[model samples]
Target: MTTTSEHTQSVATATPSRMLRYLPASALLIDAALMTLVGLVAIVGRRELDVFASSAQVEDQLVLAGPLMIVGWIATVALLGGYRRDVFGVGTDEYRRVLNASLLAAGVTGVVCYLARFDLSRGFFLLAYGLGVPSLILGRMALRRALHSARRRGLLRHRVLIAGSRAHIDEIARVLGREPWLGYEVIGALTPEYDLSEETATGVPVVGNADEATSLAKAYNADSIFFAGGAVGSSSQFRRAIWELEHESIQVVIAPSVTDISNERINIRPVGGLPLMHIEPPTWSDASRWGKRLFDLAGSLFLVLVFSPLFAFAALSVKLHDRGPVLFRQERIGKDGGRFACLKFRTMVVDAEARLNSLHEASGHSEGLFKMKDDPRITVPGRWLRRFSIDELPQLFNVVRGDMSLVGPRPPLLREVESYDVDTTRRLHVRPGMTGLWQVSGRSDLTWDEAIRLDLYYVDNWSMLQDISILTKTLGAVVSSRGAY
Candidate 1:
């Protein structure tokens, strides 16, 4: 087996390219340019072709306000941590920051104009605010997609060295490895002396013990050092390790023991100069819950209207192909273990369930789940419908009926729910979804454990932004049909 040093050297040779290093700066510059362009356009549009003929005082005010607005917007984003490296390619935090910064910039500009008695055109101000914020958000999204593409190809990622007990390091490595878009490439691990092997359970090489973590991290040229739960024996020791790494300009991250918690629910308080992390209980606030319900109702209604033609086509095709029912409705476990009939376009032969046992040996799915790459029970039209996820279109009605949401954990069949362990049953905490994180991530191809993990993560971290992101990706996943049966 290769020694830990050799493994570290091999990984260090694969460091991300110089172009990757400048991504944040490039994004910042592009945002600045976009803001300036939007501001100039707003000014010119408001003044029309007579911009130059405007009073000298007005022109001077416009010039001064334009630069100040641009500078202030950029500064606000910076202060809000929009340009942080960790926020570059994953989640909605970056977009939220950009929005916050834009609003702050607009509010400050309005206050300044009021104090100075400069009559800034309301039309111009509104136009600039409206256009610039969306443009900046879109630009960031575009950059994030580019970065994700690079990460998938192993081109842009931080070389991460994990420090912790064997079990924690293994868990961390497994989770990080599954999310390439998060852009952490684990180079190796540092564990306590009890571990003999030079490799983690997940096969991330063990480079050193915690005592030698700083040196090993440097040797590996790691971009970040992640301390898994109980990596050091004490908080003071962990602080010392962080201090040592900071002197070397290395980034340090500590993974809390908790899983599936959203950052929005976490607060850090400093007491007696010691930082304490407090986790707020998950919000089941009526307003938030009802807000989601309202969104689901509206979205489902809109989709049902828009896809009425496709739904008719599917129904006609299913009926003509096999003279079977046009829709498939099966009892599924919903929120709080309530039984509801989940709807789908019929995508199987009339006796699909009766034939299920016969095909079990060839199905290749684990217990409590059923999937087959080329299930013979699927009719020709049904296969086509499944490939494009058209069969799921009828779930919109379920959404409208309040039995499901546009996004949430997958609705589990009654049998599947019966087999769910205590931990897995947490999936029933929220209404099932028409499409969700699992649908976008891998759909039918994911292993039971992987699917359950994703479902639990979604359950704990549900947000409007996350739901939108999943829905947007679901279209791509359907088109690709990589994991569809």
Candidate 2:
């Protein structure tokens, strides 16, 4: 019988990596095409000439410019990682790369013009750079939408196999479930510890053991196999599996055991015989505290100025719907065990807090946490306000008053603060937020454990960049209304 190692070796070598096959080539071609069209327009527009101009001299100049533009496009894209598989059709990373590539191209053209003693019109380069960056970004945006739509219809997807302990494999499944646009359809998982029966784990079926992992992956025609943590017994086993998979044309992804390692801080060095991953723990200092405070102050001030009209509108809406108070100010825990009144629009009735005790037994949310999804106290206008998160607009005042921030952990109610275990209190290490990791992540859908973990992650990794990213995502999440109640 053919050994599992032999079977896998056949697959990996035989199947070319999809990175080279799909996204890169397509991206390069689209970019080159875009550059070519832009170059033609720039040449004609700068010369103040028309297509098929009566003058042969204009046509000759255009012809010469075309090849130079093509060369510049190729050189720029290569230098800027425009064809990297990892960046294709996802996130702002792709657009950022495109902009970097265009800028690099301009630099190359600038240097070449100086060296060659050609009096190239500066207007041509300026026009191309100005138009090309936005054009390329727009093109990628359109293509990304098309690709995402295709993924939803079940096309352009990869079949993947995961190898790990049951828990880690399940974690991978949950992650993949959230990113349908990534186009990973997990085929199954392989575990050495248990038979992991044929039944599906997290919607992915368990295929077989480690010894038979390669064969099973091939049998399913898997495009990629992920070796999750705690699955492979030894380095030899991993090497043997990689060698075997080489013949079967399957790619491999080794999941690291480390958690809480940000992409910014993790570096990999292939030493002697091992790929050693070097992770530097986040360095925190007093400077970070002052910087964060400054950011919070400036951001809060800007938001207050921009949203002043919205605040007036919200106050008017609340007053017209229910002749109750416009603002709801409740005492909540803040940084260093401080007390502050968190502000929000009065979405519930004036007597909502008084009625809470009577309806305690029927409360649909966490008992220690105060959440009432379908509370009878909510007015008709409150539902619309809550759905779009307009009700939380008053928290800008809290931010202005130094009681809250644009991004941070949520401030628990006085009763909820009292219910906290020692570990849960870590959330209070920073000032509370108008919208937090919990709010943008899953809000009411998050379990208490998940909520705490995310909060801690934010505290440990707090940076102005992270805060801005979270705040931007918060706007999108609020608009999409995912997991919002």
Candidate 3:
């Protein structure tokens, strides 16, 4: 019933919306405002607020210098690519640039003051930067949160055209699909010249052949083009394709066949005209060392102390609900096949474990994962506890005892561990976590295989930064309760 012209128009309209133009302008305005506010706060803290008055006869030269510093700081951020559209969302590159810019601006200001004999207050300088840098980073984080929320609602996503073999195209598409916050919307696939198909195995629509990547990309009004593995036969052809797309505003991303590798593990090197990808070996060994353990212990200790009141309340609630035990302890497999008693606030009836087999048989997935939504066994208070993950708070004790980490693979039950394949067994390299990639990703909503995949990926690519990021994302995930019981 639909004509080709109407279809084409609808498809083309999938390109970026007004958010494409608003994001950069918003970042600039926010940065300027934040820096100005920090400068004012610094001035007031140092009792140099009089510098703003025209009649103030201050020898500190704070009047002209303060405004110049704020302006220069903002300019420095823009000069260092902080305002670029590419760094606007989804990574720490923007925050890192802002930090670098702040440092550069401060150094220049110090140098200029010394060379010109301008009396700049040292206290004000330290106070301003110390507050300003963090404030700017927080501002960017808040803006990024807004961008992520919009993308999750299917707004402002990049229209990505993937050019590759079917298998590689699907792989890239899967990753992009999993992380909606990354905002890559796959418009269609550009297959290798040999095979012409209407769609991929995963049902991603096929638009054209690989050789016509540039043309098809433009036709779709793609915001980005991903050249997945096998898009071209040789280096020269790849180079030609890149050159063809240079005139368009479309971003070109080369997606290697590899999956589940973090950016930290991948290093691109220029080797005699070729970009050689160097992959660092897994960080699991290093992560299992004392540094991470020390952090886990201290962090858990702090959490336990701070949440003592909440802990008491949870315990009391469990006790009052049906007079059941306050704590539920289950033996779980931990690092390198070791067993530990994982703890949680009791959120189910006393005989809940006895009902598992029947539920499993009824659900038909009787072997690997055992989850039942609206589970009748969960107490009324238990539902609320599970929804917000207050039940998992007792895992801090497991962390204290060194059986778990603040961030690592999910702790598996004895039965679950029995079924793990060789690849999945690698998750034992580090201790299990109170919260992990699996916990924050989808929790009970994830497929058994998907949960294992995320756990294995965490085991093989562990880093303190990755751990910290997962921990931060965990807060948002808990607040949203995306995939809780």
Clash statistics: count for each candidate: 0, 17, 0
The candidate maximizing lDDT is 3
> What's model 1's lDDT at 187?
84
lDDT of 1 at 319: 94
Instruction: Tell me the tens digit of each residue's lDDT in model 1 across 185-265.
Output: 888888887777778767788878886778887777788888987588888888788778778857788886776787887
Residue-level lDDT tens digits of model 2 in 243-347: 887877677888765665466667899999788998766533321376777887888889878989988898898998878889898888888788988888888
Which residue runs of candidate 2 sit more than 4 Å off their true CA positions?
Answer: 1-21, 40-60, 78-81, 89-100, 145-154, 193-204, 282-288, 320-322, 368-374, 421-423, 445-450, 480-485
Descending-lDDT candidate ranking: 3, 1, 2
Candidate that scores best on TM-score: 3
Q: Which residues of candidate 1, in runs, are more than 4 Å off?
A: 1-5, 12-20, 47-69, 91-93, 108-122, 283-295, 400-402
RMSD of 2: 5.7
| Estimated TM-score for each candidate | 0.87, 0.82, 0.90
- lDDT score, candidate 1, position 22: 82
Please estimate how well model 1 matches the true structure, expressed as its whole-model Cα lDDT: 0.84
A best-first ranking of the candidates according to their TM-score comes to: 3, 1, 2
List model 3 lDDT by residue over 187-264, tens digit each. Answer: 888888788777889878778898998888888888888999888898889899999989988789989988888888
Candidate 1 backbone collisions, by pair: none
Task: Kindly provide the TM-score of model 1 when superposed on the true structure, using C-alpha atoms.
Answer: 0.87
Model 3 local distance difference test score: 0.86
